[model samples]
Target: MNRDNEKRVTPNLDENELMNLMVDGIRKDGFKNPIETTPAEQPENKKPVIREQNRTERISPTEYEEIFFKEVKSTARHGKSAYIDPVHHKKLTRIVQVIGDDNITIYAYLYNLLEHHFREFEELIKEIYEEKHKPLF
Candidate 1:
């Protein structure tokens, strides 16, 4: 035998041996990775380092309130109208019953609304085209 092949050899570790070695190291370290821990120091609240007036004009509380309330009212009215549309409300009720409370029903209703709008658009287009270019009748 050649000297290269005749030397005593150590057995290679199998998967289980490698896994056991890792588990043993982890157990000896109390199951936590060795990491440095440093306590955070509290930041001092000092005066502004650089004082500068805001370039943007700030709205007064009254103006802010008026704008906020107007937006809230407008959104509430729109939401009520959408929720109370008889056709949409009925379809939504049926969909909820069938689908068991899945929120995707809202998307389904939106898709149906879009489809209805598209049909209306097609009708309007047909009407306009017919008026502009009457059939050769």
Candidate 2:
């Protein structure tokens, strides 16, 4: 990233355009894990901080839209469930048939439900840990 080419992200940018800019910057500047080879060693002179601040300037909105989504095909992107309750499975199948599999709204609803419960379970686990590991002092 060059200072002459750098542009600040302003509040005036629309949601889609801002997301495109962020995506473009991320896709172009893939992360290099500093932990892979050296955890004990440290870089001198704060090079990582400087590099982080020097983000690539966004391209034009037209070009941003052109590179909107990077086609990342990965086997780990999908998962299969072991089982569903027979009644729920039937209902889900019917819903998919009626609304089509590509519909996002129903899927988002299901995802949100799962996400909310997962967070709840996380907090419960933390509480259990605190109960089991209370400090004496």
Candidate 3:
């Protein structure tokens, strides 16, 4: 065969030709037909697993009594006011009596009250001790 007279077979491929060749290679490599999936069929709406928060458990009657008496004893020892206010001690005592043996409720109530009072005290102290400076104009 004369080299110049023989028809030349050019194997250079375009992008689409290259892609078809790749697909053919993949089919030959045992991925003959990929399974078709629809957007709705896919798990797009799946929610991630999350843990639930632990709830606070109720306190026992003995614990409640212990806490109540301890507060009383500590107040007496510190010579602190027996109530949230001096004149309102009896009314406060009645309220405490009404809430007796309910440690969880008592604790929550006390925590809220203390938080409010502490914030008020902090504001008072800030106002009392706050620095005042005159502008040197």
Which tens-of-lDDT digit does each residue in 25-94 have in candidate 1? Answer: 5454653444643334324552224544563377675653333222111223244334468896787677
Per-residue C-alpha lDDT of model 3 across residues 1-137, encoded as one tens digit per residue: 68865677776657765676675564544533446656566575643334434422655766655544334213234444334565565654555667653333333445455654577478755775665544579
RMSD of each: 24.5, 19.0, 28.7
> After superposition on all CA atoms, how large is the RMSD of candidate 1?
24.5
Model 3 residue 38 CA deviation in Å = 68
Higher-scoring candidate on lDDT, 1 or 2: 1
Q: After superposition, how far is residue 73 of candidate 2 from its true place, in Å?
A: 11
- Cα lDDT listed for each candidate: 0.52, 0.49, 0.52
List the pairs of residues colliding in candidate 1.
none
Q: Which segments of candidate 1 are over 4 A away from where they belong?
A: 1-83, 86-88, 99-103, 116-137
Give candidate 3's error at residue 134 in angstroms.
13
Q: Which candidate achieves the best TM-score against the true structure?
A: 2
Q: In terms of TM-score, how similar is model 1 to the real structure?
A: 0.23
**Which TM-score value belongs to model 3?**
0.26
Q: Higher TM-score: candidate 1 or 3?
A: 3
Model 3's lDDT to the true fold? Answer: 0.52
Per-candidate total of colliding backbone pairs: 0, 0, 0
Q: Give the TM-score of each candidate.
A: 0.23, 0.27, 0.26
**Over the stretch 39-84, how does candidate 2's per-residue lDDT look in tens digits?**
3465564333322233237456455323322222332226444466
Per the 3 Å backbone cut-off, how many clashing residue pairs does candidate 3 have? 0
